[model samples]
Target: MPHPPPLGDSAGQPGRSNRVLGRRGCHLPILPQQDGPAAPLPASPGDAKLQRAKEALRLAGHPGDPQSLEAVGLMLDKLAKENQDIRLMQAELRVILILPFLSLAPQAQKEELETLLRKSEENARLTEALQRETASLQAAQTELRLLREKLQGLGEAGLQRHRRVCPAGGAGTGPQGQVPAHYEGLAAALSTFFGSNGTFAHDRLSFVDFLDEVEDALEELAELLGVSKEDVDNFEEMALTQLEAAPWGR
Candidate 1:
């Protein structure tokens, strides 16, 4: 994309120095007040001669061919609507500016004021609906946020439950029923050999039965002494080969 010419580069440009920024503001014509139902007066967006002068240098851009007519029609409709809006405003303002001078009874004026207020409220129906929709969306978002938090809490609780369920079995309580650190550590290490995820490659069934015996012997050893099984890098050290020669039994 090409960059716009710099302000300094346009120093010698004829129109650049003369160009005025912002609007000159609108002028409301002073006309004799005519009493009647409010109706917009004939209005134009700008001077036709000025518009034509500007258009001479650069004619209006348009959609090419077939769709151009439809586009033009839509644009004309928008312009017409905007022009009608000006007339409506003029009529309303004329009525409002003359209201104070109208020689009407206070009761009549009060009734008219009430009527206008009622009309204004009626026109605000769409705004009311928008407000209701916004409130409902906020309620739904709040409910969604609460459900997400609840789901997160449930996930954390499930994780805690999973942690409590020992893969190698027996979870004890406090004091005398507390699990020995060595027993916990050894059981955690041996867990893979007891389940479907076990890495045991041979005599798995016999190995599982042997593990049950080991558990019993290990429990007794924990009750008698503070020590537990160690040096378990090889299967031989844990008596994995012998049917009954277990480390805990020793």
Candidate 2:
């Protein structure tokens, strides 16, 4: 095998010394080519004109018989037309492949949109239900408060009745100018009960339970005042009769 020839050497050119510096700073020898078949030179990458010519020849894809300007121009034109046809075919094929997915796109979008709408409707319904429940709870709380106030008013009225009958330093007394110790005790008990346990007292008693306690207190008052059961019944009947007789009450 023959060693490669030096740079700038060709078949026609005579040998000449190219004094290149080696890695060790010595002058390297560039020998001339011995007679035989000359090796094909490697194309330089930086030679843009050469590369373009070679690429044109490759695309031309035919022997350069009777190589002329006209012949070369005709080959390159044919190659350019063929490349254009290939690119058009590729573009058409891309459109063909993508068409099916494009056709189904609307249905997919519709399903997604319907799902979102359904979710939105469900959220609205839940929100409405929550609002209704909140309003109902508030109304119930208000009604309960009014009932408690009414009960408290009734208790205050009972206390006032006891005070009027007793008067504080025994000013006016029932029948005789005398006050019963039991009657005084009952008044004291009423005061103690109302004073300690305020309106909405501890234990959170229900309206019915609180009314039962009021009834018990009234019974104690009647007993201590020495009022007969018949008198209490007559008084209750008379009160009811008066309410029924009134036009507003009826």
Best by lDDT: 2
What tens-digit string does per-residue lDDT give for candidate 2 at 84-199? 99999999999999888766788878788789999999999999999999999999999999999987886666556645554545744433333433444444553433334333
Predicted model with the maximum TM-score: 2
Quote each prediction's TM-score.
0.25, 0.28
User: How well is each residue in 78-141 modelled by candidate 1, as lDDT tens digits?
Assistant: 6699799999999999999888766565888888988999999987997899999999999999
Give every collision pair in model 2: none
Candidate lDDT (C-alpha), each? 0.55, 0.60
RMSD of 2: 24.8
Provide the lDDT at 199 for model 1: 41
Poorest 10 consecutive residues by lDDT, candidate 1:
226-235
